[model samples]
Target chain A: MSEAIKDLLKKNHMSVTDSRLQILDMFYHAPGALAHADIEKKASDKIDRVTIYRTLQTFEEKGIIHTIPTADNSVKYALCKDQCAEGHHHDNHVHFVCDKCSKTICLDDVHVPEVKLPKGFQPHQSNMVVNGFCSDCRS
Target chain B: MSEAIKDLLKKNHMSVTDSRLQILDMFYHAPGALAHADIEKKASDKIDRVTIYRTLQTFEEKGIIHTIPTADNSVKYALCKDQCAEGHHHDNHVHFVCDKCSKTICLDDVHVPEVKLPKGFQPHQSNMVVNGFCSDCRS
Candidate 1:
């Protein structure tokens, strides 16, 4: 886990510090993605609150992790899985937030269907989030 | 239109006022929904910025509208088809945000499927947002 963080930091041109390692660990352990509050609770014993926030920002800048928006306007994040840039990623798949566990998981293979837009609008990045009860929670 | 807002307000026991009506109007005309920033842009000219904010807060509290989390952590509001409590709603369907025109549209018919959760977790409310170039913007 630590090695993964180090590699990510090095690749992203960020410092592979202990604080960042712990924060990255949270993402590593997370089956899907997580909210700031989730990271705070899970990683508080290792990383400080401010450091986690900074690490998230830094990781996002390096394209190591990408932000996934939810229904509450709270920013959640997941690992890039090697598809992100300093300013963007072509993450055009469905993002699932489990209502059962409150965990945000990226549905990489599931793509959101194309929508019709109005004129004079340029295409940019896109994101898709689906919220519902997970299979485990339902059972 | 005025009667609609009045009816919503009265049913919810909220005070009916112009600012509230205007803010509600934006949500009404909005095919998807509007962010606070979007609301301010359409409404600040007629209502006080603070008033708009307060009215939105009240509307959210009273179940008139609900918050949708976006990729940037920006809060988006949509009028609930059925009255929803702060954390409860019957319309837990898919929501799409067009990257080209920055529009949030309700995909009420597009329902999200179930997910599998880890243990010891409770599932509650959920929000789903799909961001992409709308059909018009693509053209």
Candidate 2:
């Protein structure tokens, strides 16, 4: 767990702290992206929910993670990509929500396409979510 | 107003209703996009919030509109593209959240780029958001 946090910190160029490490590891080992409630439940009983919330927010601000909004409007979080440029928010990526497991998985490799905007409007990035039943669900 | 509703309904192949027409035109005349709250605020107070919520859900189900999750986690919705297919939802367009106006505008013509997904995962559609000060805001 510590190693996971260290690696994440190194990748993000963030100074490693115990709290950041714990939160970073939580996201790294998470098989699927986690919602706020889920993170609070599984997080160490010692960590306050508000602390976890703040941690998540800080991580997002630091570009260590990004959010995925599900059909149910629950927000999920996942690790950012290595290529995510510094000084920029996390690069937009695809998020997959599996119908069977109801798991939101980050398709980090998947990049959202560039879009052409109307006059006087300038576009910077994009987010894409693909919703469907997964292979396990179909089976 | 009735004709406008009729045209929107026929254009999107959705059923026309007082609430639906009001909601559609509310979005139509909106400079950018509208939250349910924005719709309520801009339109007559006669439409109940519950009704607005239900109507938005119906519109989403009908592929007439899609949602953009704001930084604050509130949803902002707008009209979809012409090719919006039934039973399928694609909001893979550029969403501009003007820092000045604080409005979310749907860039219909601007489309996100195609992404290649990882093995065992299928990519269907995506949503892209660009957050920055709009031209007006910059000015």
Top-DockQ structure, candidate number: 2
Model 2 sits at a Cα RMSD from the real structure of: 4.3
CAPRI grade of model 1: acceptable
Model 2 residue-pair collision total: 9
Candidate 1's C-alpha runs over 4 A off are A44-46, A116-123, B1-4, B11-15, B25-33, B37-54, B57-63, B80-139
DockQ of each: 0.32, 0.38
Instruction: Give per-residue CA lDDT, model 1, range B1-139, as digits (tens).
Output: 4897789788888777778778887788876788777777787556777887888788888777877666667777888887887545667766666776777766666664444334433345444555667656665
- Fraction of reference contacts reproduced per prediction? 0.40, 0.41
Instruction: Mark the 10 consecutive residues where model 1 chain B has the least summed lDDT.
Output: B114-123
- Candidate 2 per-residue lDDT over residues A30-138, each given as its tens digit: 8889787887777674577787888787788777777776645677888776634544666556778886688888776666665566667655445566766555564
Query: Per-prediction RMSD in angstroms?
Result: 4.8, 4.3
Docking class of 2: acceptable
Error of 1 at A126 (Å): 3.3
Model 2 C-alpha lDDT per residue in residues B48-128, reported as the tens digit of each score: 899999988878877877777654467777777664666677566656787667878776667766666666665455555
lDDT of 1 by residue, A1-139 (tens): 4776688778777776777888788788888887778888886565677877887888887777888777656778899876487877766666666765776777666665554333433335445555667655665
Q: Quick one: best TM-score, which candidate?
A: 2
